[model samples]
Target: MPLKMDAAALNAFLDQAFEQVADDFVVEDVATDRLTVRLEVSDKHLRPGGTVSGPTMFALADVGAYLMTLARIGPQALAVTTNCAIDFMHKPAARTDLLGEVRLLKLGKQLSVCDVLIYSKGQEPPVARASLTYAIPPQ
Candidate 1:
């Protein structure tokens, strides 16, 4: 299916609907079943050990999946996370941004599921992985 929204449109929707965090995330790429998002790291995202915090990584995965869903389903601000599971495999590099690669596992009428892999910018191995299920509100 053709995309309902592209990277620029998704980014604009994020800015208009969620201004507080809009700048933190960048919708890097979008396709039929996948998306790439980047999280610009800052001091607020770091933990005591200087690695990216768990919550920060979770946000990256969650946001990546959410945006990927919206890209195909249109800008649905009410689309909510019904479930999420995250695995932190390795310590993310300090001072590096995080990148999330999201792939749609399922997209039905009422729900969309996605798998996300997060990596530290410039790193090869994934630092975290997540599976998310989102509830799409009826139009």
Candidate 2:
């Protein structure tokens, strides 16, 4: 399927609708079934060990999946996460940004399933991997 929105449009939507954390995430690319997002690392996103927290990584995956769904389905704010499972594989590199690559596996009428892989910037192996299921709101 074709994309209903692109990176710039998604970014604008995020700015208007989710202003609170909009600055933390940037949509780097949007394609037919995938989206790339960057999480700008900051002190608040770090834990005591100088690594990005689990919650922060989860947020990146969740938001990346949500935005990827919206890229395909258009602006449906009510669409919400139904289930999420994540595996923290490696420790994230300290004081560096994180990158998320989200791919839509299934886009059905009532649900969307997405896979998110997160990596520390300039790293090859993924720091975390997540599977997210979103419940698409009724029209």
Candidate 3:
């Protein structure tokens, strides 16, 4: 299916629907098969070792999946994560933004499964990877 929302539309939707975290993430790119999101890292997102925290990475994955679903299905603010599996592979760079590259594995009427790879800006290898399933509310 073609995208129902683009980067600008998705960002606006985030601001209107989830104002609290709207500033933390930016929808960088929206394409037919993938969505790219950026997490603007701050001190609050860091851990003791000066690296991005696991929870921070997970949030990016979750939000990326949510936005990717919304891009195809239109703005569905009620869509919620039903399952998540994350792996922290490499430590992220300190004080660097993270990028989540999300791809939809399956997009059904009731659910969406997305795979996300998170990389610290300018890093070659992914710092973390996540698989997320979102439950789509009936329209």
Candidate 4:
């Protein structure tokens, strides 16, 4: 399906709909196969060991998946995550930004599934991987 929202549109939607964390994330690229989002790392995102917190990574995956779905289905702020499974593979680079690469695995009338790989900036291997299922609101 063709995209209903591009990176700019998605960013605008985030700003308007989720202003609380809008400044923390940036929609870097939007394409048919993938959407890339960057999380600006700050002290609040770090844990005691100077690594990115698991919750921060999960948030990136969730937001990335949500935006990926909205990119195809248009801005539906009510669409919510119904399920999420995440694996923390490696320690994230200290004080480095994280990038989430989202791939839509399935998009249907009621559900949208996405696979999200999180990586520290300049890293090759993924630091975490997440599978998320979103409940699409009825049209």
lDDT of 3 by residue, 34-77 (tens): 99999999999999989999999999999999999999999988
Q: Model 4 compared with the native: what TM-score?
A: 0.98
**In what order do the candidates fall by lDDT, top score first?**
4, 2, 3, 1
Candidate 2 yields a Cα-based lDDT of 0.96
Question: How big is the RMSD of model 3?
Answer: 0.6
User: Residue by residue across 49-133, what tens digits does model 4's lDDT show?
Assistant: 8999999999999999999999999999999999999999999999999999999999999999999999999997999999999
Per-residue CA lDDT of candidate 1, range 19-82, in tens? 9999999999999999999999999999998889999999999999999999989988999999
Off by over 4 Å in 2: none
lDDT of 3 at 29: 97
Give every collision pair in model 4: none
Whole-model lDDT for model 1 versus the true structure?
0.95
The segments of candidate 1 whose C-alpha lies over 4 angstroms from its true place after superposition are none
Cα deviation of 65 in candidate 4 (Å)?
0.3
Off by over 4 Å in 3: none
Residue-level lDDT tens digits of model 2 in 6-110:
999999999999999999999999999889999999999999999999999999999999999999999988899999999999999999999999999999999
